[model samples]
Target: MVKVEFAAALQRHVPCAPQSVAPGTLRAVLEAALAAAPGLAHYVFDDQGAVRKHVAVFVNQQQVRDRVRLDRPLADGDSVFVVQALSGG
Candidate 1:
């Protein structure tokens, strides 16, 4: 199973906790997580099913480059971290 975790900063806005799920592509795993926490979908994804601009998804410490398509595959035991991207220099 893949472990999905929410960053501390994002947890302030939503109730998503660390969870384990079946391995699949980034989109598939994310959709499954959203099903478990219906309300969290809006904060992570946009109306067109794309990851929100402010959201960052990392798989096993590597940033997901395909934000629009989210086709990156996840293997068993992988860790996915979801965080709100920070801006402003």
Candidate 2:
């Protein structure tokens, strides 16, 4: 199973949640996560449903490219971490 971790900013949406999910592509993972916490969809993706610029997705410790192609395939035991980028100046 692939693990999905929500950053502190996202924890409010999912309380006491597991950090893993069934093995699948990024799309599948996000879909399932959204299914469980529909409210997160709007915060993570844009109106067009694309991952927002400030959102980052890491698979197995490798950062995923910012594109719809996050559909990148995943295997069992992999991990997917979803975090919101923070910026201040």
Candidate 3:
């Protein structure tokens, strides 16, 4: 199973706990998560269905490069973390 977690910043907007999901692309897994926390989708993606600029996604401790596509494949037991990135000084 793939584990997905939302940072404290996102938890404030939608009360969700870390979840375990079937292995798939980052997009597919996050889409599943959106179903569980319907209200959290908007905070993670933009109107264009892309990850928001202020958000960061990490798969097994490696940061993802494609914020728009999120096609990065996931493996069983991989840990996915979505966090709000810090900006400004």
lDDT, each prediction: 0.84, 0.75, 0.89
Give candidate 1 regions above 4 Å deviation.
none
The TM-score, computed over Cα atoms with residue i paired to residue i, of candidate 2 is: 0.84
- Give the 10-residue window scoring lowest on summed lDDT in candidate 3: 63-72
lDDT of 2 by residue, 49-70 (tens): 7888888877777778765666
* Model 2: number of backbone collisions: 3
Q: Which prediction has the highest lDDT against the true structure?
A: 3
Q: Higher TM-score: candidate 2 or 3?
A: 3
lDDT of 1 by residue, 1-89 (tens): 98898888767867777788899998898888767777888888889988888888988898886778888888998989998877664
Query: Per-residue error at 18 for model 1, in Å?
Result: 0.7
lDDT of 3 by residue, 1-89 (tens): 99999999999879888888898999999988778898999999999999999999988888787899888788898999999888875
* Per-candidate TM-score against the hidden true structure: 0.91, 0.84, 0.95
Q: Is candidate 1 or candidate 2 better by lDDT?
A: 1
